[model samples]
Every structure is written in structure tokens, then in C-alpha cells.
Target: MSIKLGIIGGGVMGEAILSRLIAQQVYRPDQVLVSDPQAQRREVLSQRYGVNVTSDNGVAAKADEVLLLAIKPQVFKAVASDLVSKDGNHSSASETLPMVISILAGVSLTELEAAFEHQPVIRAMPNTPATVGAGITAIAPGKTVTANHIEQAKTLLGAVGEVVEVSESLMDAVTGLSGSGPAYVAVMIEALADGGVAAGLPRAIASKLALSTVWGTAQLLQDKQIHPAQLKDQVTSPGGTTIAGIAELERSGFRSALIEAVQAAYRRSQQLGK
Candidate 1:
């Protein structure tokens, strides 16, 4: 509605949020500002979204009421330094600082608060599906955040996908599950395609079938609000091919492998945070 949002990176995730916000009419392109170190990226986003773009992170940070930190975690410290004064406070002389929402992976609220010097911070973990407006994001707020701050954060993130509020302690689990889930689903799709090819289908047809099956099954489960097991049982008859396939999957420990994968990712996320 107004020119009040600033994003610190113009990368894929950053641009995804920007595009979705505009598509949802939550914010207009002219109302949003973005910053990227790459001049080409800045120009591209400006041309693509009609949003103001600058090479100066501080300029974007100072110009907005809400700041979205979409920069890579490895470069967060350097970028943050540009937004703060020598005393580690917002460089602006104004008493109030912008509410910050960060999508940087493995960065905890404690680290963000420290970097921004006690600014209200919301840490969000959103996966790649957000690029297409089908993502789910988990958000955790810092100690200084208020109810209003939470609403603001949700409104911004909800433009792209579903939002879940979680305690900071469970963020690593969220990171493991939905945050890294797209890769797991992609692997599953590829394996399904390969299986179909092994059974004598053309590669292109196999790939399309696998992708559509996954998409349809997901839609069905969501639309019906039924457990996956219920759906599996519905398709598995006493002597049907589905049961034969199910047996093979069980024999291969498919479910357990997925569970272990999520657990491994959770542990890795914790390690990265440390």
C-alpha cells in the first residue's frame, strides 16, 4: 500500500517474496526497495519488478519500516555491519528501528539480535517452493518482539505460502522437515521416474507421470484431510499391484529412510547454528 518494505538481497528467495507480495496485492512494486551487491542483479530486479533497487544495504534498511534479510548466511555479518553504526546500533539517529525478518539459514534470533543490537527479529525458514507460491514457512520471534511484530512478520511471509509460528527451540526440526523437504521430494520424483523407466516407459513419459502422480497425491491428501496411510490403504487391494509395490517399499525401509534423513538434517542444522 505504501513504500515501506526493504529487502537486503535480490536473490531467488528475495525475489520470490517480492513477486508474491506484489501478486497478492500486499505491496506494490514501487512501495518496495531492494539491495544487492551485484549491479546486474539490482538492475534486473528493478526492471523485472519495478521496485527501487540500490547497491547500498543501509539505504534500503533506512528507507523502510520493515526489513527483510534475504542475504546468504555466510555473508550476513558483513551486510549487517553496513546497517549498524560503530556502536552496533542502527546508524540512523531516529529512536525506532525497523522490524527485521530474516530468511537466512542457520542464523538464530540470538545472533540476529546481537548483530542488529537488540532490534526485534523474526527468523523464517522457507523452502524453494516459495518461489512458486506453494511453500510453507516456520517463523520464530526474538525476545523483544511483540504481538504486532508477529502479525507483521506473518503478513509479509504469508504472501508467499503458509506460515507456522514455532518456538525457537524447534526451528532446527522445521529446518530439517519443510526447509529441506523439497530436495527429498525431488529425489523421490527422480527415483519414481527411474523406476518407471526400468519398467519400460519412455524417459519423458516416466518423468511426467512421476511428477503428476506426486502432485495429484499431494493434492488429494491435502484436499481430503486424510492420513497418507489411509490413502495408501485405499489404493492397496488384497492382491493388487499397489500392495506388491508397498511390500517392496517396506522391505527397502523407505519410511524409515525418510525419517532418518529428516533427523540427520535436523542435527546438521543445529551444528550449523552453533
Candidate 2:
């Protein structure tokens, strides 16, 4: 069965999802409804994808089976108030309320449910790379969500990239690890490129090598199914260059620094949600 999908914002992330959906033809453009206050953004979406666009949040909220709250967490309460007020007259329990999938970072399921009046809420953390259809999304369902709701969330998230299911309690950790993980990885890639440049490689070539190295290493980890330590050992001959660099990194406490960064992010997520 075809599902009606509603997007309740037209910011970068919301537009990214819309663009990917259109590019992938996951759903008919006409089936997607978007509401955003920004006229320019709405015009861009409507002109490019032929998706329905409106300034009224209620119009978007009422038009679809799956509603994505793509607005920022700071403004979410106001948006949720509007949705709940508009839903005041909706009384068909047999017809499920729209499955609310929120991509607002650090917003908990309880906060979402409370804001939207106990709607079936799925809180998801998707990274910025979703704009390129290369994101990892983590989904955590609220107490009111059903099995069908979870599957629906997965299907929608999977349209963009890989989707992982995690306990709502662990969602903060996911936010720290994967949601904010891209920036950390980007920093490492930049540092690697800098090192290549310092080693006399041209800047352009060094960048390409750094990115490819990271990508290839990730693929090896996934495809080889060997532990990362084993892979490192395989690359590091006794007293070899690889081992020397690894020793430097170990001395610099790279692993410990990463661990602390993730923990900090997790704590920040928890604070933001509260």
C-alpha cells in the first residue's frame, strides 16, 4: 500500500529528504506534502519536485500517514503545539494517527509524545550526509509506537541509507557516535590529507588519497569481518611505517580522545533532550 508522507519543514535536512525521495522515486512526487514558512524554499521544492507545498503546518499534518518533524528542536514545541491543536477534532482511533518521525537532534520520545499529545512517535537521528543519500540513521520508537510503526520508520529511513534500530535509552549514545560522528571523521580525513601534503604530495592528490584511504579502510572493515586490531596488525610490519604512525597516534591518545568526545556528545544530547 502506498503511504502518504508529510514533511513539516523546508530547511536543509527536510529539503534533502525530499530531494532524495524524488531522485530515488521512492514515492510519487504528488504524494509528498511539505509545509514550511520560507516561501523561497517551498517554491524551490515545488518547482523542482512537484511536491505539494503549504505555509500551514496543519495542512501538511492532515495530508499524510507518516509525518516528519524536520524542524529544529528549539522551535519544535511551538510546531508541536500547532499540530496538536489542529488534531483536536481527530477522533478516529481505528484510523491511526499519523506516525510522527522526528529528525530533530536530542529530542526524546517522551518529549515528542508530550508535545504532540502522545502521538505514535519515532525519534530518529540522521546525519548531515543524508543530503547526499549516504547517511546512517538510528531510530528509536516511543512507548506508544507499534511494530508496524517501527517498520514504517525503518522503510522510510532506509530510503536514504542504512538504518539501525536501537533502544530509546541508547539513542543518546547513537546521537553521540553516529549523528555527530561525521564531523569527527571529517576532521580525521582533513588531518590525513594534511599529513599527505606535508609528505610532499600535491594538495589535490593528497585530498583524494586521504578520502579514498578512509573509504577503503571502512570497506575493508565491513567486508573482511576481521577485527580492526587484526587489520592494523596485518598492515603494520615490525618497526614499519604503519606501526610508527600508529605508535604516534597511541602516544597522542587518539582512541581515548575519541572516547571522550563521544561521551561528551552523549551527555550534550541528554541535556538538550531534557
By TM-score, who's the top model here? 1
Query: Cα miss at 126, model 1 (Å)?
Result: 0.4
Cα deviation at 107, candidate 2, in Å, is 1.8
Candidate 2 lDDT tens digits, 1-274: 2338888998988888888877878778989989999899889989988998889888777645788889978898888777667763133556556888999887777787776654688989888888888888988888888899988888788777889988989989998998889989999999999999999999999999999999999989989898988998899999789989998999999999999999999999889877
Model 2, position 246, has a per-residue lDDT of: 93
Q: What is the lDDT of candidate 2?
A: 0.84
Candidate 1 error regions (>4 Å): 86-94
What is the C-alpha local distance difference test score of each model?
0.89, 0.84
Model 2 TM-score relative to the real fold = 0.93
Question: What lDDT does candidate 2 reach at residue 256?
Answer: 98
Question: What pairs collide in candidate 2?
Answer: none
Estimate the TM-score of every prediction. Answer: 0.95, 0.93
